[model samples]
Target: MEVYYSKSAKDALREMTCKLIEVMRAESDNIPFNLALSGGNTARQLFALWQEEYRLLIDWNRIRFYWVDERCVSPEHEDSNFKQAYENLFGPLGIPQTRIYRIRGEEDPSKEANRYSELIDQQLPKKNDLPHFDAIILGIGTDGHTASIFSSCHFLLNDIQIYAVSKHPDTGQLRITLTGPVILNDTPLLIPVIGEDKRKILERLLEARTATEDFPAACIVYRAASAFVFTDITI
Candidate 1:
């Protein structure tokens, strides 16, 4: 794991976008570059940056978008992760709809998990039986959650399947998230955990070299082939 500190959140996101473009350009060729994205207010900020900066410059046809996790709700729902990404990024890119493999949050959670699992099996390239994504970008919550993997949901860290369902620890809302064994592959992982609000969480995590299930982000940092953390938080 390696960390890069930006003077501010905007600067960190700017660097993140540059790295994302480079990854897409380098990885996209024979097939659509499989990219999975996490959802949050931070992601919204990044997507807005992408739209304003590189929306027209890149060949978006070479990329396929996937969500790291989604709340169980209609895509039109205000809380839906797909809605967030689509409104901010995917909609602006004008990529083919076929290339967007979003988990159906409106469908039965179990069925959607199976469907997404099948889609992963059929769409992405496999490395030693696990799907290989070109890039998997995620964010960290102050409470140490990443995607839908909360404190008590330690099983998600080792879930080898493509996707699985979890109940939010606080809300009990069903969620479909990419399993760690599938997303934490050999591909370069881009984790942008911005904002001054994350300082305490970053301190606790950095002080502990171990990946505890208590803080799910630790698992990602530990399992990824190489992880790059772009952040504004200073410790």
Candidate 2:
């Protein structure tokens, strides 16, 4: 694991984008670069930044976008992760639909999870019998959840499936998320944890050297193939 510190959220995100571009560029252009993305207010900020300044820096054509998780709602729903990316990043970049593999959130949660899991298994490259994404970008919730693996749903940390259905600990809202096994595959995990609100949680996560039940984010930090954290919080 490695950490990059920034003075502000925008600066952290700027550095994150540059790092992503660097990773994408290192890949062979003949093949598609698979990237998994998370959705949240922080992601919205990153998308906006991409639309404004980094659009030209990335080879949008070679990029295949996938979601790390999605709310169990219609794609057009206000809470839909795909909707957030489409409106902010895809629309502005004119990324083709052929390259976008979104989880059908409106469908039955179990069925959607199975469908998406299969889709990824068939589309992405495989290493050690698991689909290998070039990179997986995720955001951390203040509660220490990452990719919908909340404290209440810690079982997902060992779920054997590539994707699984998860319920929000408080609201019981259904979500489809990449399971721990797949998430910890031979792929880079990129995280941008910004804002003063995250400092304490980040500190706690940093202090813990191994996966703990209380802080799900610590699992990724300790077990991922490689993890890079970009943050603005001064800690």
Give the best candidate by lDDT: 2
What does the lDDT read for residue 113 in candidate 1? 92
Model 2 whole-model lDDT (C-alpha atoms): 0.91
TM-score of each: 0.95, 0.98
Best by TM-score: 2
All candidates: CA RMSD in angstroms?
1.4, 0.9
lDDT of 2 by residue, 143-178 (tens): 899999998888898899999999998898999999
Per-candidate total of colliding backbone pairs: 0, 0
Model 2, C-alpha of 144: deviation from truth (Å)? 0.4
Residue 176 Cα positional deviation in candidate 1, in Å, after optimal superposition: 0.4
* Residue 126 shift from truth in candidate 1, angstroms: 0.3
What candidate 2 gets wrong by more than 4 Å, as runs, is none
